[model samples]
Target: MKKATIKDVAKEAGVSISTVSNALNNSPLVSEDTKNRIIQIAENIKYVPNMNGKMLKARKSMTVGVFSSSVSGHYFYILVDSVFKELRRRGFGLNIVINKDKRALLSNVLSKNFDGIIVFDNERVGEHEVELIVQNQIKTVFLDRDLNGADVSSVLFDSYKSGYDLTKYLIHLGHKRIYFIEGEENTYDNLERKRGYTTALKEIGVEIKEEYFFKGMFEESYAYNDVISRFRLGNSQIPDAIVAANDYSAIGCIKAFSRLGYRVPEDISVVGFDDIEVARYFTPTLTTVRNPIARQGIRAVEILMDMMNNDMPGVSEHLAGEIIYRDSAKAKVL
Candidate 1:
């Protein structure tokens, strides 16, 4: 079987190639009846248009690219889902590429295959690449880092405020000996949250102890092992409360404490950030911060569209997170 093209559609519909092309492109020069008839013939012949050719003609791909390192966690899942839905609603296609290679990622961004791009991987997109993107005038919206300049915008979570509020809430609950399970080192969100936690503790005149910090790497298993191993070494001095980087880490800490014959919110209080779906259903119902994951995606697309269509200048927006009190954390027993 032969593949049908615009010429084939024109021949089958008894119209010229230009007429067929105009009809397919929805040009007003073609009448509605002729356009419908040509479209029907094209569909009947199973004609597939060349997207690259069409993009070249129109000088627009009508697609947006999302670049990220990994879309493994619940946060990313919700964010991508929202972004796809919003793009579809706006009559745009989505292209997602997950690559840890900086060179490859930069190459894709410079290819100009997409009308705009949304970035999530901070490590892959460094200062030099960002400068190149600006120089090329490639419209981009960054979700992980706050960056605002020509042809670039950013949508970020107010992690610092969320962290400070959570810490202050725990202090209000009379928790003094507090511990923190840190996420990936040097990541924007992780660093901001840690800064907030430390600043709150400092304001209260609480001495920051290095031993109180544990490595979670934003993984449940890592947090679980870190907590369990520390306690297994006969370290009897347990903190009054523990704060995890995210909900998964918080749940891991809870599990570890449970296995050690400790009850959450009773023997020790635990709190986390990012109110993931399972947070509400967990045994102790995570006391966590509700990050606006979906909102961030929606805003990123909106900003990118504006930049691509209206040549709008880059803008920075920060969404706030609210602490949801649950069964996992409570006041200390004085």
Candidate 2:
């Protein structure tokens, strides 16, 4: 005898493939009697549940998940778009889950509903959850963060380099009164970019002022409120330059500055990170660094597919981005 298969079981049970699958997975759709009948028929055919034939048939789901820590995906829209297209091309389904509850996120992954997952949210995920992911043999690719294990891959953007280049360019333009708008407190990208900015400033022998550092959550509202609070409290003389964490915050800073009777590249030069679509057309044409969202998305999906198909161990990739200079930032000639 060659071997018994799901086809053999299905043939004996006189049921569809989906029906057999549902019965094997214990789906509620199948009534108790039908479920017992299928199991009895399968057993009669010598089809053990743990046999390689049965296990392999039930292993794959052909679905991948993309989870993010942020409430919204606006900042990383390009990445999500690329991932969506790539997944479609590869005949895989994409599930985007946003971070709202930690337990829910872990449970979803552990449930093995997806063949693989590309995680962008790690803030709420704990070590135990990661261990469970490893134990369950879940395929994962993390963005801008690392989970050290054989089962996890990491794809990190070169935020540090981009931030360094952007800040150094502003410094070269003779801007010293630089007000740096930083992003979220716990994010890896935020910390790396801030380090790059501070490093560039230190190399120039500029005394870093505490007041020049504005803590932000990489949001328009945070940037806007920072400006309002500073202006209301007085002594809020316009800085020579404003380096926002990203384009959204940069745009918000521009709006606030306009209402405060300030002009871009005139009174205070503004620079943004992440070359979003509107950055080039915005008033004064914002100068910013290139954010390689599309590239990251494509590469992440590629790695995930490899892992899913070839049983490859997790790997890491670090990509670099460059600065895009336009008219927003002006030289503050001393």
Candidate 3:
């Protein structure tokens, strides 16, 4: 005789395949009488009770995956560290994968390995490019940038608020003309942070001239070269202060400023975001926003566990960042 199957149990119970599954899993929707009858029929049919089989029926694979665009950066290292820590604390081993190319990243996500995935990558990774993330029925949580219309969980730094706060700090110190150094144009945080800077300037009755805005790559060298090239071309008028998108870029600005015989916070005040480890130990410690880097990792695991266990509704969380005051910024004394 052929082995009994879910179909056999469903047929024996005179119900649909779904009804039999719900009965076997003890889902609250099933009536006590129906559940008891289904269990009796499953037993009589010699159906073996297996937890793995139940999980399979529920479309769960019992594993989690995390991705970063590239594993070469300091921020990526921080994010990976936090994610692993949290996942392990929750008793879930994590799979860390980096997709060097954007196209391949999408392809990897389309090819499912485990249950859910969390992403911490730059904005070059688009919402449409990640449509495969949703189509695969894989739960997602985006760490850094906000992907519009992609229905997924996110735990990101408050970029707009951080920018506004940082700019306000500079302005309050009597700096009027502030040079704004930005990240990639396609990045959401870059745009939001710029918006905050503009908003603060507008509120303080300061006019923002196009000459003071500079866009550079995420690398310190890129920002340093961009600033150096622009400064060398200038006719002696420079902004009184500078706001960098991140600590790496800020370090670049500092290096360029020093080479040009300009002192930070004395010749020009500077501020940065995502206060990475090196920010604190630098010559003139960086005044920047403390992004909840490690906390996001812990939270991702908590959310993933909830997702795996069906503990809560689809949750989206936003973590806040606090600005750390240090010697990099100073009030201009009359």
Between candidates 1 and 2, the one scoring higher on lDDT is 1
Off by over 4 Å in 2: 1-59, 69-73
- Candidate 1: minimum summed lDDT over ten consecutive residues — where? 50-59
Writing each residue's lDDT as its tens digit, candidate 2 over 189-277 gives 88888888888989988888888888667888889888877876558667888888888788888888887778888888888888888
Provide the lowest-lDDT 10-residue window in model 3: 48-57
Clashing pairs in 1: none
**TM-score for all models, in order of appearance:** 0.81, 0.78, 0.77
Top-scoring candidate (TM-score): 1
Backbone-clash count (model 1): 0
lDDT value, residue 14 of candidate 3 = 88
Task: List clashing residue pairs in candidate 3.
Answer: none
TM-score winner between candidates 2 and 3: 2
RMSD of each: 13.9, 10.8, 13.5
Query: Candidate 1 residues 215-282, lDDT tens each?
Result: 99999999999999999777658899988898888999999999988999898999999999899999
User: Residue-wise lDDT of candidate 3 within 1-334, one digit each (tens)?
Assistant: 8867889898878899999888776668999899889877876776643323233225445557787767666666777888777766666667877867554465455445656778876553565545545444456777766542333567777888889999999998999888889897767678878899999999988888888787666679989998898887666587788999888889999999898888987888889988888999997899998888778777877775665567344566667789999999999867
> Between candidates 1 and 3, which one is better according to lDDT?
1
